[model samples]
Structures are given as C-alpha cells and as structure tokens.
Target chain A: MDVRQLSEAVTEKTKVDTTARDVEKIISGLASSSHFWEIVCATQKPFSVVAEIIGALKEKGLVRVDQEGEITLTPQGQEFLKENFIAPRRDYTCPACEGRGIGLEKIKEWMQKFDELTVDRPKAIIDYDQGYITTASVMARVALMTERGDLEGKKLLVLGDDDLLSLAAGLTGMPKEIVVLEIDERLVNYINEKASMLSVPVKALKYDFRDKLPEQYVGYFDTFNTDPPETIEALEVCMTRGLSSLSGEGCAGYFGLTRTEASLKKWSQFQKMLLSKFKVAITDIIDNFNHYVNWDYLLGSIRDDYSFVQVKPKLNWYRSSMYRIETVSGFEKIENRPMPCELYVDEEALIYKPDKSR
Target chain B: MDVRQLSEAVTEKTKVDTTARDVEKIISGLASSSHFWEIVCATQKPFSVVAEIIGALKEKGLVRVDQEGEITLTPQGQEFLKENFIAPRRDYTCPACEGRGIGLEKIKEWMQKFDELTVDRPKAIIDYDQGYITTASVMARVALMTERGDLEGKKLLVLGDDDLLSLAAGLTGMPKEIVVLEIDERLVNYINEKASMLSVPVKALKYDFRDKLPEQYVGYFDTFNTDPPETIEALEVCMTRGLSSLSGEGCAGYFGLTRTEASLKKWSQFQKMLLSKFKVAITDIIDNFNHYVNWDYLLGSIRDDYSFVQVKPKLNWYRSSMYRIETVSGFEKIENRPMPCELYVDEEALIYKPDKSR
Candidate 1:
C-alpha cells in the first residue's frame, strides 16, 4: 500500500490524529532505536497512539516486531520511507535550556543551596501519585519567574509541595512570602523544619485541595503553583483552588500536565476550563519542561502491561510540560467540594489508583 | 506610600493586573533604562499597563519625568526597592535561541537561499497592517517545524503569504505540497513567480479569508500556518479557514498573537474559541518568538501619542509570540460569511485601519 493509504488506514483503526507524514516520522524514529520509550519521546506523542501506529505498520508489512518486541522497519518500510523523503529525525532543541528558552545560569547559587536543603527529602509516595521533578528544574522555574517579573516580593503559593518549589522560591529570597498547602503531613513537617532552620519566609500547612480553602487565603496571593493529578476532576478542583487564591486581574498560576497520563482530549477540556470557567489567559506552555525522575513504583505498576515499553528503562522517561496562566479581568471562584474517590483514575491513567482513605 | 499600597493603588486605578511586586519591578526596570519601550520589553507587560503603572509611580513621588520624557527613580523609590530586596531586572533567557528553546543552525543553508530569493520582496503597506518578520525568524520557524516532524512530506498551507512562509518552507525541499492564500496581490504574484522559478511544489492564490474557502481546498491539508490580524473577528475568520483546510484529527496549525495588539481579555476570548469552537490543543507558546522589522508607518501612527514613549525608538520593538495548536478527535469548522470593515479594529489594536476595498 502507498504511504497515504497506510496512514489513512492507521488513522481509521486507531482513531488518533495521525497523518501520512507522522506515519513516516514514526517509522523514521524506529530506524535508529527499537526501544519503545525512546521512539515515544522522539515522536512526542502518546504511548498508546504510538503503539497503535506500530500495529498498523506491522499489519501493512512495513514493520515487524520480533518475539522480544523489538521494532524494526522492514525492507518495504525502508524503501517507502526513502521514496517519501523521510529523513532521520533530528532534535535541534537548544542544548543549554532544553528548548525552554530559559536557562539556570543566574540562579546557580540558589539552586545549589536548594539541592543541599532538599537532599534528604521524602521519596515519591505512590498513594498520592507524587513524583517530584529535579532540583535544577525547580531552579529553572524560579529563574523564569524572575525573568517574567513574577518573583521578588510577590506572594507565592504552592498547592502541593512534593516538588518543594516553595522552598526553591523562598531560597531565591525574592518572594515576600511562600505558603504551601500539602496534603502529606510528612512533607508539610519537612518543609516547616527546613524553613524554620533556614529562616526563609515560608510556611507549610496540611490541607487537601478537595476541601474548601481557608477564608484567609481567598483573594490573597499574587501567584499560585501546583502539579496536580491529571484527571479531569483533579484538574477542576486544583485549578479552581488556584484561581480562588488570586487577588484578581493579572495574578498568574503555574501548573504541569503530561501527555502520558492525559489524552489530548483531556488537555482540550482542561484548557477550556482554564479559559472559560476561570477566565484566564494562558501565557506560556513550555513542552517537556519538568523532567521527572522515575519513581520506585513505576516498574511494579500497570504501565508494565502495555504492549509497548518493551524493556526496563534506565532513563528518566516521564516528563510534563509546564503551563503558566494569568487572570485578565477576573475569574470565577469555583467553590470547593469533597471530591469522589475515583478522581485520580481514568481510562488513560497508568499509575493512579483510588485512595480510599480520603 | 509603601510598596503594597502603591501596587494596590496602581491596580485599582489602572484596572490592570499589577502587584506590589510588579510596581517595584517597573521601578527596577527604570533604574537602568528610562526609555518606555525598553522598560516594557524588560517587564514583558502590556505597554498600556506599563504606562499606567508609571503614571501611578509618578503620582506617588517614587519617580519623576523630565520634559524630554526621561524617567528616573526618586531617592525614596530607590530606598523602597532596596528595602524590598528588588534588584536590577536581569534577563537570563538563553542568548543563543533567545529563549525559544530552538535555533536556526539546522536550516542555515535553506535560510540563505530564502533570503537570496526574497531580496526584492514587497515593502510592507500600512493600510493592511502589514509588516514582515526578519529572515532569521522565518528560518527559525522552519527549523521548529522540522524538529516537530511537521515539515517533511506534509501537505502544508499558508493562510497568509505576506511573511512568505510558504516560500521558506518550500526551499527546504520538504513538504508534499505548499499552498498560499494571500489577500495581497503583490505578495501572491511574487510568491508564485519565485515558486515557479525554483520548481518548488508551491502555489499562491489570491483569496480573502472573509469569503468562503474554495470547495476543492477543503480538508486537503495536513498543516496550516498564519499570522492573522489580532482582532477577535480576524482570529475567528483566519483560524476557521486554517481549521477547515485540515484533513482531520492530528493536523496542526501555526499562528502568531501579540500582546501589544491584543489584550489579555482578547487573548482569553481567542483561546476559548480555539478550545471550544475548534477543539484544538495548544502545544506550545513561545513568547516574543517573532521579532518584526519596524514598519515605516509605526512612528506616523497613534502609537506615537502615548505619554510613556518619551523618545522615538531606534530599535525594532514589535514582537509576537508563536502559537502551535493541534487537533485531537476532530474540530469544528465555522462557515465563512462576509465580515464588516471594523473586523480588524478593536480598542487594544494599535496599527489596524479598515481596508475599505475588502
């Protein structure tokens, strides 16, 4: 079959946003690396969609998968790619900043100090779906905030402190005050101890976002940051809480969303919520900005049962793009209500399970 | 007045999102440069908002403006900045890529050819609000497309050819087809002449976006690109044209939006339309990605009447962030109808004048 016909068949079967060119690009990614995770990263597509694309290619006799599940393009696939002018995929993203367009040179000292302070921090707890980003990433976030004039005397809030972004912002000595609302008491106590010892203007309070925000925090903060669960319900609750805390009109919020757990449909829904329900303008969205270190529970989870992801990965495979949204005039204050237990698990979610205790 | 009180006052008076910290940031921006354009670029806020902030600062005795319009911090302003730990604003964005996280190294040869071909391109006419970006910016755009695998053997569409993006993409010897729908007859003839001479798979056709798209072109493209006039109505028309040309789900489109021309309220409204009406996912938004050469008519326009722009700018200051959106399941294509003359003129728009001929 021709390339366009094959791509059309794949799109029909998989029901994904796929083009003949993307089909060629996916095949080109497999030329150098048969590893599934590497191909996914190269394609910048969801693993589930990539898996289906490969299945269609195999059925078309353009690619083959051995018993070990290693993917390789067949002679027909190679010739098709050549005739279609599909060259080897090249990543030309800037080396210094990883395509975030911002680097960490200005905050080296603060980043070093943040690393030292959080070296003994708690590990990722699978129950909370908590996996923290690298300290350098946190520092990069601070540097961006500084560059955007969001730091230095701004009231900063962190809805979840597993990443310890509050401490990082506090270390810059830029913000007027940093408040962290973390559900994990362990993280809260840890942050409090460190803030007290270091004497930074930071405070940690234990509060689940599923509950109503305290009266004092309403319309009080200039910025809010969160890395919430990717489920629709979690995003609604978390984003609503972030909006409620803003003083109004130009208050900014930062959050992270991943393609691994959330489909593009969910992303569309989330953005719709932010724009219509919250009346906020999305200012920036840097792709793959937050690189997450693999947590301990990844290998033991349902992700292993997927048809792709053939081998155990030694690399940090999970990452989420960073998003910054700002209020223009005002935003709706979505009243907080107790969330159901199934707010974390959805059809596309891999590692999340219901936390019944809440 | 204290910093918080000053910020609150500024926010109240201007009805823009200003924080106590942002007031200090404005002051810090002024510490080194008194030029209005320089400060606006440094602070990355709207020009109108910055002008109001400076007015508030002057009222509060933190700054003074000379007859020539140079601004300087008062001793109390300096002291307030010092006491609040506000330092001189430093931009740590990566120097090489200018914080776009992508560079033009990969397409240097193609960029050179593009420049050589378009050396005698048409001058930007002010009535259509036409101003083209630098050649380097266009090359950087092509590189970003290459890195995203959107260029190779794809059916590409350019909604407007004033930027000559179709020619740039064509010179790469990629893309299965390139189509340009341009309102400017000069740009259309120029692009078609060059494409025929170069033997590139590109066609430029004169078409107004307010009219219905040609039936033959519907659902015929894999990707579309445009830099539309930043009015709410123009965005709707241009974006709908781009969407209607896409084959189906997984197609991508590129556009530009500038804060200088569109307010955050307009941005929020536009994003709402993109998400709800079109069902597209915003993948990336690189701030200040497209730097425009100062159009000849800028100094002769209403923008010169602003109080804060104390002196004429010698540097190129107009810029717009690049936006990339992709369809997921499917998108809605709004039918085109004849639009009004005021479609391009809005309260926030600075350079646009109605083209009566259309």
Candidate 2:
C-alpha cells in the first residue's frame, strides 16, 4: 500500500526503482487515461510488474481482477490512485548501465579502493541551497577514476566538489595536482585534512565564483570536474571556472547536469553555450551516474517561499548525468556576470519538475 | 573456478548474470584486443559484478592487473578463457531490462505465477535439434494473457509450441479454440493431457510444417504464434503456415526471434518477406522477453559435429524478442516451395553461430 516502501525494496531487489513507481503511475494514469493494455505490456516484464501492483491492491481490498483478467478498481482504489499517483517521480532509471554497475572488471577493483578510503558524508550547508544527493561513494570516484589518460597525472580542478570527488581523485594517487574550490570552509578544511593524512596531493581553497578567476589559476589545470547547481547560470559559472582552469589542448572537464531541473531547451542552450564558446566538444554523457539522497533539508527550508511544497522525497529519487568534455583549443572563458546574485530560487527550481515522471 | 557456479550466484544477487562472464570474455577477447577500462565500468553495480570475477580469478592466480588498471591474463586465465569462453554465450544482455527482474513491478509478480505452474523439462530431440531454451513461461504467457481483447475466444494456432506457450495460453481459459502443430510427439501428448485435464480448449496435433496446410485447418484460425528456427526457409515455412491458418482480416500472430541467430541482413530479409509478401504489419517487438535454458541434449548430440562445445548456459543469456503482428489485409500465403527434405540440422543449425560471441 505504501508505494515508497515497495519502491525502495524493489530497487534493492531489482536495482530498478523507477519501474516499481510505474505501477502506481499506471493506476493513477488509468483514472484519466485509458490506453491499449498492450502499451503497458510493451516493457520487458510488464506481466510481473502489473501483477505485483494488482496483487498488492487486491490484498488491500482496493482492486480485483475477474476470470477474463480484466482489472476492476474499488472506489477506494480509485481514490487512492487519484490522490497518491498525482505526484510524479523525481529520478531516472537505467539498469545494467555503467553507473548502475555493469562496467569493466578493473573498475570494480578500483572502486573498492575508493570505498576503502571513504570519509563521512559532508553536511549540506543550508546557505548553498544545492541538492546534496550522492550515489555510492566509490561510484562517485569510479566515474573519474576510470578516466585513465584523462585522470592520471593530469592537473585536475574540481569546482564545488561537494560529493568529495576530489577525495575520490586523490585516492587514485595519480593526479599531478588536485584543487578543490569551495564556498564552504568546512569542506575545504575537511579535504585539506584528509589530503595530508592520506598523502594525496590535494589543496582546498576557500573560493566563490562571483569573483574573477584568480590570475595564477587561469589556464593552469589540465582537467576540471564539477557537480554544479542545476540552474543554467550556476552551471555556466562553474563551467566557466573549469574552462579557465584548462591549460590548453587535450584538457578535459567533467560536470553533472540533470534533465529534471534543466529542460531540453535549457540543456540545448547550455550544451550549445559550452561547445560553441569554449570549443570543448562534448565527448561522452553517462546517464544517472550521481544518485541523490533526499535534499529535504533544503526543501524544508523552502516551504516559506512556495505554496506548492506539500511533497517530500520518500526515496532516493534524484540523479544527474555525468558529462565528459574535452577542450579542442585553448579554453574560452564565459563572460563574468559578476552580480552577487541569489542564484537559486525556492524548492520549485531546486527540485526537478515531477511532470517528467521517469 | 567454475564460471557457471559464479554466474548463477551473480544472477541471484543482481538478477544479471551477464557480467559474471565478462571476465572470461575479456580474457579471450584480449588476445586481439586493446581497450580502455571504462568499457567494463558501464554496467550496473560495476564494482560488485567485475570484482566478483576478478576476485575469483585472483584466488586461483589466473589473472593480474597492472597498477594502471590494465588487465593481463595469466597463463591459467588464458587457458580457461580459451577452453570455456571459446564456446560463446548462448544469450544476449540488455543493460537494464526487466526479464532479468529489472522490469516493472507487476511483471515480476506475474512472472512468479508463470513460474509456479512449472512443467517437467522436456527432452530436446537431437534429430529435430531445436534449442529447448525457455523464457519465464508465465511471463511469456502474460504478454498475451493480459491482452484480453485480442485473445479471448480467439481461434489460436501455434505452429511450433515447443516452449509450451500453448499451455500458458490455455491457463487463460479464454481462447475459444487453440491448436498446436508440433513434430515432437512427447510435447504434443503432454499438451493434450494438460489441456484435457485443465478443460482448456486446446488441441495438439502431430503435424510437420513441411507438409501442406490441412484442408479443415486452412484459413480457420484468427491468431497464430510460433518460434520458428532462425533459418530463412524454416521461418518462411512456419510463417506461411501461420498465414494460412489465419481465418480473415484483423488476424494477429506472435512469434519469438533472436537478433543473434538472425542477423540484420537476415532480419531485414525476413521482415521484408513478412511485410511485403505476408501483408502482416509488425505491430510491436518487445525485446529480451524470452530467456532460455541451454539445450545440453542437443549440444551433447553436437559432439559429433563441432569439437568446441564446453559452454553450458551459465546464466539465462539467450533472449528472443517477442514480435506481435497483425494482418493489415488478409495474411498472404508464401509461394510454397514444397520439398521432402530435412528441415533442420543438428545444434549447429539450431544454436546461434559460435563465431558471433556476445
């Protein structure tokens, strides 16, 4: 009856959380939309997926199926569907994918190394107002760690390294230099402490993007990585710093962007802006690499700004695709829009639009 | 270490058994290969899947990885790869599909029901040399069972119901008439017994597809289903029989196909034949719907054929896409090239080409 519990359980059993939600989505969808049942059956295991929902609802006295296998929903079931199913999903599902764990053998070995040196999850600074969703700690590291020639002995700069990707990079003991530019002094101090303790050559600097790129840091690093705020302005700002950090040709940068907050229009514009201006060709895009924990801490703080704030993440529902970009020429810089702007809005802009229920 | 034991264990944990074989595949492939490690990091739970294989091999001192994460096969791993992996996979892998339980929720529950009515595994006739690979019986049945409008009281004809799809269909108790044309006498008798006892309106007839359509049976059925052999002739022949059985317009048929056995060139030709000649528009093709057991009996029979056949189905690797077709006009008959000849060969013809390893 509790779709959230069933969903998380399904994710553990099947490594597929979104499809379990599809059952509720279908039941709710059925109230207003009637589609050819075969459309639902088009999926890999529609029979089992549908049967689970039907059996659950039947056990709860909410739905029933006759001898002809026609499903009939009780009045109670209809009401439940209407109310609960109205909310859309906040995450994406891609199973057997590299991010979901169907990757190379040595990657598994390296990821275990990253996990072995893992630190406690950093506290989300309320002022930053960013979704602090994290996938497996070692998984975060694996994405960049497995980037062989791109990562090894390459001077790397991570903009707003909130998930501690720098530590992941440091664990490899391969980067020529690793720099962490952070607004939070606590994270900076934390990284500096771990870097020294682990003998990983990582330096953490208290930094903000509103200021111009530090002169010495300009075109200094070979690779940059960031999981920026989903907003285009913030993404542009962080990426600009990354671009500025790139020393020359063959330099690379990795950033995380999500389809939820950034629409196709936004993504198109953002991608165009990155490619056309910076000459950093988008080489690869890995889907659903960074799975997020509930950022209700930030959402709870946003109830004062928006009326439509009844919903909360009941499960790990947010993810960002990891994008790998390489510079073709000397990196071009984004024009400094140096307004000390309130970059993030209320929960509306922060949380992904639930309308795209996938 | 036995890869078979490891693969099944992995399937139990992740509902994905493909990754368990990647180690061997990679080892065998390495002789003629140079690759970036990221390729292996692309599957779900890459950390766990790859590690399992690596750890197993390391325990046996069968492989080694350089500090740079480049893998080098030990002599033992090379020998093992050559011996075991040479036989090639019997199944295909869809990165994150549901048939492996990565599917939607209802489908999983329904598959359980299909699994419950377990029948004794039937013997594969070496002369027939049909791969007795089975998908989840209830899962396959559910695809059509859930199609209430299309199936209820429909006159159904299955040209080669060796997987016992007829039994699954009969469980619906909705078909007005169902007939199976199977050369295997044991399966034919088994279905008749199961049908009579269950009061399902299905008749199993001892029929060879090479024969001309029987007079009473011609143009008598509304729907047809088959999993014809991948050979063009057999597929054409069985489909022609299915076309002949279709009573009139609005008739539909379902069949299973494998991308491995039927190459794109073959698929294109087959599709052209089905569309251009048969006049049946392909309505839908749900991929990886059928997972199969290795036909050891037929493969054992193959000892007289290929010398290299050590491969047992370590996991459910073989999958056939379920194709749904409906007659736009009346189903068109193939120009019958009637010949009294051996229709199918040994496992060499029935199984996929060993050269095309997954």
Candidate 3:
C-alpha cells in the first residue's frame, strides 16, 4: 500500500470516527435544561456546530425537540447520563446545601469514611469566633489529602482541633497517631468519647496554643493542622506551636486560612513564617475547601457592624484556603515570636472589616 | 375523627412517603464503578435500609441484580442520572486538567460567556518561570467575577500580564478601560496586536514595575490584576505598581498568588506590604483556579535534579490561588517599599525548590 493510504487506514482504524461518542457525550452533558440547546448554540459552540450535533443526536435517537424549540432528552440520552454521571451521597450528606452548587457531592461519597467523627457545635468557651469547622470540610480535607497519600499511616497532631478532625483522620483507617491539643474541655471529652468508640487510636489533651507546647510532642508528629486566629501575634504563636509539634524532615502541616480575616499583608506574613521560619513550603492549596456552616452566632455578635447580618448567610459563603505545607530543610526553630495572651483578637485589631458600612 | 386517628391520617397524608426517592438518590449518586450495595452496607445506612431500597429499585425495574451479586442500572436508572447530574464543558476546559476533579464544571457552563476571549499559549521570552496562566483560569476568573458584577464597566490595569489576562477582560466587553503595563516587549506587541484583532479596546505599554508611575495612570483604574514574580522585591514592585494604577474608593485588584513558589515567610512580607501600606483586603480566593499547562520548558530546565521530571507531566498539575483584593479606605500611599530594578527574580531566590535533588 502507498504511505498516504497506509496512514489513512491507520488513522481510520484508530479514530473509529469518535464523532458518535462525542455527540453522545455532548448530548448527555448538555441534556439538563430545556434551553440548553439554545445555550450551546448561542454561547459555547457556534450555531452551525450545535445544529450539526442536534442532527446527529436525533439520528442517534438520543433527543427530541418540540415546536417551541425546547430540547428534551430521549431514553437513550438519559441512559447515557445514568451510565456516566450519577454519583452517590456519603455519610457526609449536606442537609443544608444538599450537595448542590458547592460540588461537595463529587467528594462526599468518598469522604464518607471520614464520618466516624462525632458532631459538636462551637461553644462560647473556646473562640470559634475566627472560624467554624464543618463535618463536610473535615471529610473533604481527609479525602483530598488521602488521595495525595499525604495522610496514610502518619502521626498527625491537631494544634487546635475544635473541629474534631482527628476523628476524621482516625476514621481514614490510616494515621498511626492522632493527637489533639485543645483548650475546650467539652471538645476534648467529646472527641475522646468518639475516638474510643471508633477505635481511632486518638488521644486528646486540654492544652492551649498560648502555653508552651508539651515537650514530648516536640518533633514527634509527622504532620500538624490548625485554623489559627487571624492576628499576627496569635497566628505566629499558633503557627509556631504547630510547627514545633512537627518532626524533622519532610513533615507536613495543613493550615486553614481565610482571605476575609487575613489580608494580603497577613497572608504574606503567614507565607514568610511557614516558608522561611518553619522551613515549610506550601506545595498545594485548595481554594475555599473549608466552608464554615455554623458561623451564624458569630455573625450575630457583629451584626450591628456588618450589614449582611440582616440577610444572614444561608449558603456556605465563608470558606478558608487549605494549605498543605511540607518541610523543606528539616524544621526551623521558631523563637520568641509574640504569642498574644488574648485567645481572641478584639474588633479594633481586625485588619479585615467584613461590612462595607465601616 | 378522633384526635389520635386524625393525627395518623394527617401524618399519612403529609408523609407522602419519599423513602423511594431517597433510595433512588442514594443508588443513583453512589452507583458508579462501585459494588454500591457494599459501600452502602459498609459506610452508610443499615442493612434493613439497603434491603428495602434494593427491593424498591428492583420492583421499579430501574436496576437489576445478578446471582453473582453484581448490580447494573437500567434505562430507568439512566433517566434518574440525567435528571440529577451531568454538566456541560466550556472553552475554559483545561488542556492539563480538563476541568475534571477540580470541580470547575459546576460553574463553567455559565462560565462560557466569559470566554469572549481567544486562547493564547504562554510565551517563553517573558518570565513564565514565575507562573503559567491557563486560558481556563482566565475564563474562570472572568466568568466567576463577572457573575458577581466585578469586571463590568470597570477600568482595569494589568501589572505584568505575561498571561495575557487583559485579553480575557477585554473579551468581556464589559470593562470600560483595559490597560496593560508589561516588562516583556514581545507580550506588549502580542497583546496589542490581539487587542486590535479582537477589537477588545485594550491598550498595552512596555513598562517595568521599578519605574516611577506615569502621571495619568496613577489611581486611574477601577481594578488591577497581576501574577507577580515570587520575590519580596519583584512582588512588592509589581504590587505597588498595580495599586498605583487603580483609582481611589471602591477600586479593587486581583492577585494571582501561588502556594507553591512563595513560602510562608515570603507570603507574610507580601501581606504586610499590601495590607499595611496599601490598605487592601482579600475578600475571596479561589484555589486551583489557575492551572498551568506550559511549565514543561521550565521543568525541562531542571530535569536532571527532579525525579518527577522523568515521568514528564501529561496532565497539568501547576495551579495558582486567585485573590480578590478590595481596596479599603480607597488606596493608601505605599512608602519606603523596596522595588527591585530587575523585573524577574532569578532561580536562586525562588523558595520553592522544584528539583528536590538540587
């Protein structure tokens, strides 16, 4: 055979004219709403391309169009969706969002294993004033990290796991040790109770970031995670404590930081502290991975200052950036960086004012 | 009717018995590639729940089970999938990631209108050694913000748009004025040429961050966007220049910061510089918004030192954090900030050591 003919034959065989499958994919993905065909023609693909696709799908018996120009999927089209798209809901099903819009469903069926955790609301004693950790975010953290193999059989320390993420880690049936340091006795007891029930090899201690980290924990943990206060003083102290808890060389730490409280200035400071001082580099950060659902009370507290209080956040608008930090050159010794005695920063010191009224 | 009997009747009437729908939702969402019954048994509802659900689905003729205990969805089941899931792809589809796993599709169908801009590859003559901006990300940024009315009829300035994000903004046909100040002459010409071709009403000038701001450009734009080199000097210069380009009061800036290159310490310094001097507050940051497909050349440069280089990435793994910075108190004057004369930071200064062996 001639070279061109041989090439054409090879291409024909390999390609198998995927136009059929491509049409199916397009139809199945787009068969959601009535106006989808018009949408496809008007915005994404050109009218001619879309018309061609519609014609192909009609020939394939995957769709039907009415006189009103509305598009509806045929049984074959619906079958394609069933074959390819539908995913299950895990134990972390959202009663609030119902896995809508947030795309939590994509991760939840897999995140179910992290649901061995006990649920608790933030108490007044500890300052959840900064952030609230939802069960969904905990499951997501474990799932995403586990996918990266960052959380398997490692000794992890939770600097302030008010969220009870240790339970989630233990639920992974992975982490060798799950240690939590918390000032809130309620969280400690609740965590311990669930940990024991789940056989989660976890222990909780009533401690605070303000105090010196327990010596035995120094360089003992393979990883650490925290959602520290937003102020420089509190963040430095909390971060230093978290870093100090880490073992030397390639240890990791997960930090849940928010843009709402930490401005570019504060974010830069955090990067400097973790990257330069602790010798930890941020390799990955999933944007707004940690969504806070139970922050209504805190918002109520500042309601007078912020206008959004009247509307109240029905959706999970508050989210934190999750940083996966890895130790670069062992661990850096964080010395007397100011650890503010105050557990929470007052309104005056807040760099980020949430409401435009201010 | 007696009170108890009446209550029972009312309960029966209102109960409407949605257990069937619940069972279907569970089965449909969880059915993909999994012995879903096993998953249900292992992590979710009890055995009775599973048995009842399976019986309901089988009776409805939506699913079938074989003697081998394997389960498959029928045409009816596919219809359920069509009713519940499946998403359309957009021009913002990632060459590296294809908008999969990143959960971008949830927003991309609506994101296509933002793709009024065309696709452009990263140029090497300029400094993509810092960050690669995917057309997917540009569309995502524009789409997401445009949905929120951020880019509509606003004057925008690009500090170092090697990514040609300005083109995407111009394509929006929303921004009143799109101005670009870039150090790379090639980018300036390329962007200008495309701006004219696309009729995007964008103008580009060859400019460096270290140079003093020209008179008209100062506080002129409603917003600014930049993916600065990750050095305290380069970043500060690039940032200050961007801020200077914006007009006072309600003006904003979009920052493309990466968790990979800048360490915590470096990040802290940046935050302090922007937050303290500029009075900018970060309102939102979407992670993994910017996926880089053009880092192969940079990765190739240090191929010998990095072990992963041997595998050669077919999937785009590089991503950046998109920061939505709202200027508070309408742009504070930055003073005593160090602006490095050099636009690019050399490899030695990079905190992120991609090649571990080095």
Q: Largest TM-score belongs to which candidate?
A: 1
DockQ of 3: 0.02
Best-to-worst order by lDDT is: 1, 3, 2
Q: Give the least accurate 10-residue stretch of model 3 chain A, judged by summed lDDT.
A: A86-95
The better-scoring model by lDDT among 1 and 2 is: 1
lDDT of 2 by residue, A139-193 (tens): 5444443422456546788777667778877876666788888888888888898
Candidate closest to the true structure, highest lDDT:
1
lDDT assessment of candidate 1: 0.77
Judged by DockQ cut-offs, the docking class of candidate 1 is medium
Candidate with the larger lDDT of 1 and 3: 1
**lDDT of each residue in B1-358, candidate 3, tens digit only:** 1222422332243221122223433454335523532333222222223334554556667677664455567777667655643211112122333322233444454346444434453345423454556666666666545533346656778877767778877775767778888777778888898889878879999876777777788767767888877667787777778777766534567777654454334454566555555655554554455766545354354324222123344445455667676554324554423355654543323323434344
What is the TM-score of each candidate's chain B when compared with the real chain B? Answer: 0.87, 0.65, 0.62
Among all candidates shown, the one with the greatest DockQ: 1
User: Chain B alone, model 2: TM-score?
Assistant: 0.65
Instruction: Provide the TM-score for each candidate, comma-separated.
Output: 0.89, 0.41, 0.58
True contacts kept of each: 0.73, 0.02, 0.02
